[model samples]
Target: MSCRIRIRLTSSVVICLALIYIVLFNGLALYSLTKSTYTPASVPVNRGRLYFAYLGFNTWKCKIPHFAKQPLPLTALASFPGSGNTWVRHILQQATGINTGSVYKDYILKVVGFPGEGVDNSSVLVIKTHDWGINERKRYQRAILILRNPKEALLAEFNRKNGGHIGHAKTEHFKQSWKPYVNESARQWFEMAEDWLNFTGDLHILIYERLKADPVNEIKSLLNFLQIRISQKELMCVLENMKGRFKRPSKNLTNYDPYSHEMRSTLLQYEQQINRTIDKRYRYTTRSHT
Candidate 1:
């Protein structure tokens, strides 16, 4: 072959190889990204059984089950402010490997703001909102309502507004006394709880205290309720994440005398009213298995 022809042929071969490499690499990367973003409807049941079997030579075998894929709806992790909504979201992201969206538009908050008007997509949108009233419930297919003790939640809000990390140093609201803020926070807390209690849809109520006490069981319940199946390895990873990285500082306002007698009275009254109302509708379940 002529020298010029040989050189041109070699260059063409190299270009073809480079194109092939790019295409293969990009295809693999896209597949991995999508797999990591969401849990598959079914995984190897034998894998889970092997994992457990190795840990203990127990004869229990994991049963393989098939799940029919269904269209995911817009789910909301709704709660009153300071009710551990963010913490639950963290656990969910770790457990299910899905990116949960938020409705708020705050840039600092790192949230995917609500979709544009009439823009419905084909993905599950998990939003976090403190909005009260049953009118908003019509927009969501399912909701996980996280409730906290009114006294503790109000106190946490009081500290958050006064001096905690979320406090604005120069804002007048941040400079105000804790009593008025606690009263207002308590009022809003009860209102939000009442609204969720009245919601006539697929709703699950999770108590913040119960979550703190038995996170594994509570998280399992949550996963079952959401219809997301995860293996034991994933559950262990989630528990580790909860223990190591997701732990937040406990804000105890009682130690600092953040509430006065009147404030305490107001919180107690609202708590009684809320408990009396919701106790009839929702009972906290400690079911460990689905």
Candidate 2:
């Protein structure tokens, strides 16, 4: 072969190697960043075993009324805002083995304004949400909601919003803006809880603290509420593998833009205030759970 041709071939090889190295290096860097940023701001606990219910939902595709190899666009999982809705959704995603991404990412979880980069799109669309009303999911065909103790919900919110006891994301602004809504917000929680408690709607409500306490039965109750029946073996399997957020102490959390230590005395005051103010409706568990 000519010397010139040989030189050209060597140059091409070197260029290809360089490009490959760049791609690999960048990929690793991206992975590290994502891993670091992905720390959780733990979610509130609910009644029953979360794993069982989530698996059952994922198994929804093959259920009697529903039959499709792929999950429906209309199917969703939402929670009321300010609650640890994000963590709840993440655990469900983990247990169900649903690939995250696609349609739900854009509409359901637009929290941080960052790229809602999903890990996978093939999994069931478990939307993490906190907005509750008769028609919150009106845009979607069907949904399931997870409910948390309003006080505890506030506690999580306080931590998540600023990594402090009471996050002043825009504290002064929040106070001024929140004043009118404060009473309104409490009323809304009461109404939403009571209304949905008796709701004969198409939605299913999963109470948070109860789920945390007795996950198995609560999950069964939820399944029954959804009219979703699963076999005992499958139920057992899901329960065995499940670990919801409240299962761990949230006192140490990275709930916000920066992490926080709820173990502080000052922060405890905010938690107490929120606990005191939340509607009493969600304070008690339903007759069955008790």
Candidate 3:
């Protein structure tokens, strides 16, 4: 064969190999994105790879008709479980008339939530999560850290698990007395709080007590932080509608009280530490409606 013919053949082979490599690499990256959970630590270094994988995933996701049509900055409402996440989400949805998303259902479960509803043209998405596995400040546009008094929060959780009462006789799942459960719950709460409190990203700290005391104003502050707008009338309307919706019989059903002197002291210590860390690391203050 002539030299020109040989050169053409070599060029074609090179092009084919390049195409194959691109296909294989992108395929592997997409697979990884699907299977693994995303954390700041685990984020791929290759910007190009992550970009394409996200694009492909979104394209596939858009097939669902109910997905948000506009892409918005993802805003996260993050907290440990039983820390009033659901109530806050309800308020947010009611105030804005926009559906908030959940990463647990969307990312972890790969069900119809958040980004799974697929990419839309929406300007904002609010997601709920109990995960502190990733550095959220770096990932999300904004994050709201909702906290409650650990003792109350843990008691609420215990009661919820025990079928709306705390003093149920020890069962298989909760064989230990209430004290152990509360202690374990508090430990988990502190661990999650520590992980998230260290985040240097845009964050707003909300106290559940403050919200309970004055939901309208507290929700207004939250909406402002999120850059969401709602009129005074609308805000009041939402609050009025949501009133008494979250009241639980557990509050009256449980004669057992765990907020003893020791528990109070322990929680106070953790709160002080958390407060100091917040003061040092974050610009946002704990909401005080007093």
Candidate 4:
């Protein structure tokens, strides 16, 4: 071949190689963008893939329609503080194969009931709360309300240290805290109990003591109301998982300061009365629902 002709042929080969590299790189990048954790914006509304004929590399441009709505399951787990919802949640986490090892931050963790945190959200969610929330938004279902006799709840409260504000000890010390006197504490609890028992609602009430005493059946009843199906094997696994404590990090401790010993002791003084109040408020039945 003439020198000029040979040079031209070499240049053409280089250009073709460059173009092939560019196309391959772009295709891989597009595939990766689709699978990333952060959702991609420009990848069409539904489905679009550039399919290439392997033998010739001829590509077909295509798009697929996306379904109109995404379905996510939402359920509410509401309980009086120290009513053993921690154990309930543990059972759920184990059965779902959700958290493989480390804890998974649930996308829909919200506090409902007293001070509702998830009052606004588009995602399907599960909420944990003590106070009952009125179903004004039309999003919430009738609740799974767990009740512990206020007296036992009071004892369990100190043991689990699950009190929202009280758990703070307002201090890192778990001691040197401020709280209503024990008598007042008990009175406050009982009063809160009274409030809960009398408050009528479409609620499936599960007694906590009964759950601890007989978990499998109590849980089945609880799950039935929620419409969650569980096989006997899954039920056994869930019960096994509920035995441990789920101690989560508390941001509340960061901001709250400990109170003087006097303050904590004073709160202890009225604990009994508070507890009694809670005991009285601890019940509701289908009859009341009627």
Candidate 5:
């Protein structure tokens, strides 16, 4: 009887110890899941784990803010589609701790993270707009124009319209709609640049390639342009969480050229005209400042 009782006590102790270990392990895991920080370089490349880690990690790192308490000057974030406008908005939101607004109601964007979609009021930091025509330009007293290379912007827009953000256009899209779309898109691209360059309001031009090359300094310039003050800690947080959810993944380069000879010629003509207009505007601005 003594031996049997001793065995039972030993079993009970073992079971209790097992429960304690299990509890401690799970507690640690939950802590890591909720509180862990991630930088672009720090995230591991394991696809399955990376997806979940990003969902949990980046979303919690930056606190999305409510609408501004006081009325603000309605500023415009004007860009042609696929010119990294959404990415810029994400960066601004991360840094300023205020929601950015858009004129168009993008339900997908609203569901993902942007709470200020379709709101064009004074509560938003800047109202996003693709329209650079005079009528649309008149709505804002200040604007930031984001310009991207025509080739890249057009292709990116095509992919976005045909597929969801971060997805590629299907083969059918390239074969059927690519040529005509390129012609129409190129015209709009040139017009967008020309119209925004002539914007009478306080306007700042941001080149997409330059922003990619030096994100920190570029973003600093952007903040200065918007006259938004941010602490160093907040700026660092923006750097850490720079890439918001909408950025498309890099595509594999192939030897095939998507643009035909005729398409290339047409695009080049518009691109040159846009460049000339921008140069003239830059020179005029420089002379005016002097």
Candidate 6:
């Protein structure tokens, strides 16, 4: 009887150890969910492989899209600063498995998964820029111009310049930089839209508000424009993994009203002009295409 009891005890110990191992292994696997959903654009990463057990009965790893071995058309993703450009790029990267490029080399962005920063070539999917200068505009064979509300875009750009991405500008900036900043930015916003609408290459205008409201459809439309074929699984992964690292918090940082009466009027006029121009341009394009 003592021997029988010893055997039973040994079996129980083995089972308990097995259970403990299962728990720890599963915990580590789940912990990995906190990392970036997709792999970095530039480098091959061991951690880039993401296993989604929760996705379905079957599990799979997300792979980053490879860059074109041969040179492709140089496309530009032009937008005013603070127009959700980075966030859109993140979504594009996640959806297409391709890395998007930018004219500016932001080190922070490079580290946080945008390895294509400063790479402006066919290897990257598209190059991002805020410049509407003639020289900058003339380089791209195609363009995707992202338009955002001036009030929001200006404030977001101000916050980014004064603070950091996801950081809020100081209340004092309202008293000091807000007026001139708004004046210049509002004008730039208007001009940027006008110039891009007249872009001599294939152009697609993506409104920021529409994207926020219906990402799947907007992204699908965008992909169609880029002529990038995306699978349903990949698109699902992108939708599920929405809201990447760069999106700023929705709350306002300060209690002060940054927009003065004159500033508001000027911005409103510019906004109206941009909206009308966009509508007119698209109507003309639609007629031409048909």
Best by lDDT: 5
**Which sections of candidate 4 miss by over 4 Å?**
1-75, 96-125, 132-139, 159-181, 194-201, 247-290
Per-candidate TM equals 0.64, 0.46, 0.63, 0.44, 0.77, 0.75
- Give per-residue CA lDDT, model 3, range 177-281, as digits (tens): 676776776778888888887666677888898888887778888988877787778776676755322344433435544456887777777777777777777
Give lDDT tens digits, candidate 1, residues 40-121: 2111112223111112221112221111134467777788866776567667666765545555532212211112212222
Sorted by lDDT, highest first, which candidate order results? 5, 6, 3, 1, 4, 2
Question: Deviation in angstroms for 38 in model 1?
Answer: 28
Relative to the true structure, how large is the alpha-carbon lDDT of every model? 0.58, 0.44, 0.60, 0.44, 0.76, 0.74
Q: Which candidate comes out best when scored by TM-score?
A: 5
RMSD of 3: 15.3
Winner by lDDT between candidate 5 and candidate 2:
5
Better of 3 and 4 by TM-score: 3
Name the regions of candidate 1 deviating beyond 4 angstroms: 1-71, 111-122, 162-175, 243-248, 251-255, 284-290
* Per-residue accuracy of model 2 over 56-162 as CA lDDT, tens digit each: 22322211221224653544455544554555444443334343332333311322211233422223344444445566545455556666655455445544443
Report backbone clashes per prediction. 0, 20, 10, 38, 0, 1
Query: Which of candidates 1 and 6 reaches a greater TM-score?
Result: 6
The global Cα lDDT (0 to 1) of model 4 is: 0.44
Over 1-290, each residue of candidate 4 has an lDDT whose tens digit, in order, gives 69999899999999999779767755654554455332232321123454331223211111111111343244445655556665555454444432111012221121101112323232322345554434421334454556665444554454334232112222432443224333444555544444444444445666666777888777788777755676887777676556533332244433543334664454344444434544555433321100
lDDT of 2: 0.44
**Which is the better candidate, 2 or 3, if ranked by lDDT?**
3
